[model samples]
Target chain A: DARVTQTPRHKVTEMGQEVTMRCQPILGHNTVFWYRQTMMQGLELLAYFRNRAPLDDSGMPKDRFSAEMPDATLATLKIQPSEPRDSAVYFCASGPMSSGNTIYFGEGSWLTVV
Target chain B: GESVGLHLPTLSVQEGDNSIINCAYSNSASDYFIWYKQESGKGPQFIIDIRSNMDKRQGQRVTVLLNKTVKHLSLQIAATQPGDSAVYFCAEKDWSGGTSYGKLTFGQGTILTVHP
Candidate 1:
């Protein structure tokens, strides 16, 4: 159906390696969000984007983390020189800005950085 | 920072029984609250939501209660089933910021297990 889709459902990479997670939001969704979930921090919003433009990335560590929506159908979260602490489940969600604040999430990408 | 948090880390319920999961929010400015269920290896699924103007709202076999006075929220599941077992999370949105923006602050989830 009309559900958000994520690529590379699971990933294992060594520290200092580059990792990229991709998401395909549901059609017509204008707002996309990136979140990280860990046992210690729970679910935290890492970034927010509207209409393919980033509106907030305050929660993300700009030094290595970057989020971008190359097109309406593709949103990507990339980590350069990834560290062990970056290991966690990353989720991508999309929703309409005007409709009730309901965000539809993709299954999620389980990243393990050694 | 997380605006919502849970009072309990886990809850166990018997099949056909009712289960209640509680959450507390730190921001009083929050106007919309929602509950979601996440199964193992799956994304969080929308359960239900309630507005600050209303005290309670119900959907299908689930009911959400919002206590604006105490900044508390609760989700009640009627006749718990095995399929309902999952981690439940409560999220809040602050519309007082002047823009809905679809920003949702989520809480540390509570794991619920239904015993058949």
Candidate 2:
């Protein structure tokens, strides 16, 4: 019954504002991923971390978006000076270190930038 | 510019009937494939997965078939229920430049509707 938990399930902000989304991964899970879902783009992976270290962030917007796993339990995605085009559902998923691991997802944080 | 895709955007079926959703991947080097079900407004849930080495895999009432020769993947659900109505996405894992575990590339997805 373990699940990944995300905070601020819904967020509304004006353009140029800063938005922060938090996630609490399943206890003992080591891999965390952040993804954005939009009607046009579908689901796109933004970043991923393993063992509290950042593994990849190439998919993320280099200028405004950043993802970090501050500790084993908490991971966060932040957008500074967020734009209207950035509005979408942000999902956090966590999985094991083994191959063919099943990534479990959180309910997701819905963000709307006006 | 490369992408994975579903054969159909939508499919409708009866309650007792079986449903098949198909996906085609452009990457021949992909070694692993996974099927995920996403309910409206929810994240994708793991349904089943198959490796390139295997042609077919089954679990519960669901079966996944992989045709590597054609680069096609399908999900078959027996006795489709209302709860089984959701968007199904096929994802492929390809080896990254230096990463140990491959990164997942998802298909556009197919929505399934089961009617009683």
Candidate 3:
């Protein structure tokens, strides 16, 4: 079965370190989304891309977080100078626009910043 | 500001019992609703979905009901099993023809625990 693949399923980093999470969306899917999950905030959409173009990143921190789809198969979320508060599970999801709101999610990258 | 919210934060049920999870949305522009189940240490999985034009949709053993008049959504699971224990979330999407089209807004999830 087709599924979204995410790298670094678990990661532990010291504060101020840079963390990068990678994702490979399902083949033939054109839209990708990045979401962060925390106990306090629940799941929040950080950004999304359509056809390899950034659609929105308003939910992400403008200063430290960045999401990019370098190509159709590759999507990445990076945090520079990450802080402890950045610790959370980052999920990548993808779906075709024509699918009518059905999105598939990867296993998620678990990040723990100390 | 528009938001999606759950009626309960947690629900407990016995195996073989039926369970219902309810969600409410504030945005009238939302046209699509989805129910997702997330197990511990895993990402959310799609269960079922319903559109604004439809009142109910059924999947394998799950059903989704949408009431546009009240902006309410619900997920009903028949014959709940122990394996059904997970956090359930409801998401809404706006198809209002803008940059926000297809963007999903998820509600705070409700944790469902099934006692065997």
Candidate 4:
């Protein structure tokens, strides 16, 4: 079965360190989304891309967080000078807009910043 | 200012019993609704979905009901099992003439625990 794949399933980093998470969306999917999950905030949309072009990143912190789809097969979310508050599970999801709005999620990257 | 929210934070049920999880959405323009189940240490998995034009949809042993008049949504699981224990979330998408870009807004999620 096709599914989104995420790298660094678990990571621990010290405050002020740079953290990068990678994702590979399902083959033939045209849309990718990045979301952050925290106990206090639930799930928050960070950004999304369509056809390798960013559609929106308004929910993300522009100062330190960046999301990019370098190519159709690879999507990345990076945090520079990450702080403890940045600790959360990051999920990558993808779907074909033409085939309805149903999206499938990866297992997620678990990040812990100390 | 629109948001999706759950009616209960947690629900407990016994194996073989039926369980219901309810969600409410503030946006009347939402046209699509989905239910997802997330187990511990895993991402959310799609369970079922319903559109604004439809009131009910059924999947393998699962059913979703949408009450647009009341802005309410519910997931009903038949024959609850211990494997069904997880956190469930209801998400809404309002294409709004493609302005929303098919983005989904998820609710706070309800934790379901099934006892054997």
**Runs in model 3 with CA error above 4 Å?**
B1-8
* Candidate 2 per-residue lDDT over residues B20-115, each given as its tens digit: 999999988778889999999888999999988899999999999999989999999999999999999998877544553556778989999999
Docking quality class, candidate 1: acceptable
What's the alpha carbon RMSD for model 4? 3.9
TM-score to true structure, per model: 0.93, 0.92, 0.95, 0.94
What TM-score applies to chain A of candidate 3?
Answer: 0.97
Please give the range of 10 consecutive residues that has the lowest summed lDDT in model 3 chain A: A95-104
Kindly give the number of clashing pairs for every candidate.
0, 0, 0, 0
Clashing pairs in 4: none
Please give the range of 10 consecutive residues that has the lowest summed lDDT in model 4 chain A.
A95-104
Can you rank all candidates by lDDT, best first? 4, 3, 1, 2
A5-109 in candidate 3: lDDT tens per residue?
Answer: 999999999999999999999999998999999887899999988898888788999899999988889999999999999999999999888636688899999
Candidate lDDT values, in order: 0.90, 0.89, 0.91, 0.92
Q: What TM-score describes the B chain of model 4?
A: 0.90
B1-116, model 4: which lDDT tens digit per residue? 85644344999999999999999998887889999999999999999988899999999989999999999999999999999999999998767755366777899999999999
Better of 1 and 4 by TM-score: 4
Writing each residue's lDDT as its tens digit, candidate 1 over B40-108 gives: 989999999887889999999999999888889999999999999999999987655433355788989
- Runs in model 4 with CA error above 4 Å? B1-8
Question: Candidate 2's error at A109, in angstroms?
Answer: 0.4
DockQ scores of the candidates:
0.48, 0.45, 0.49, 0.44
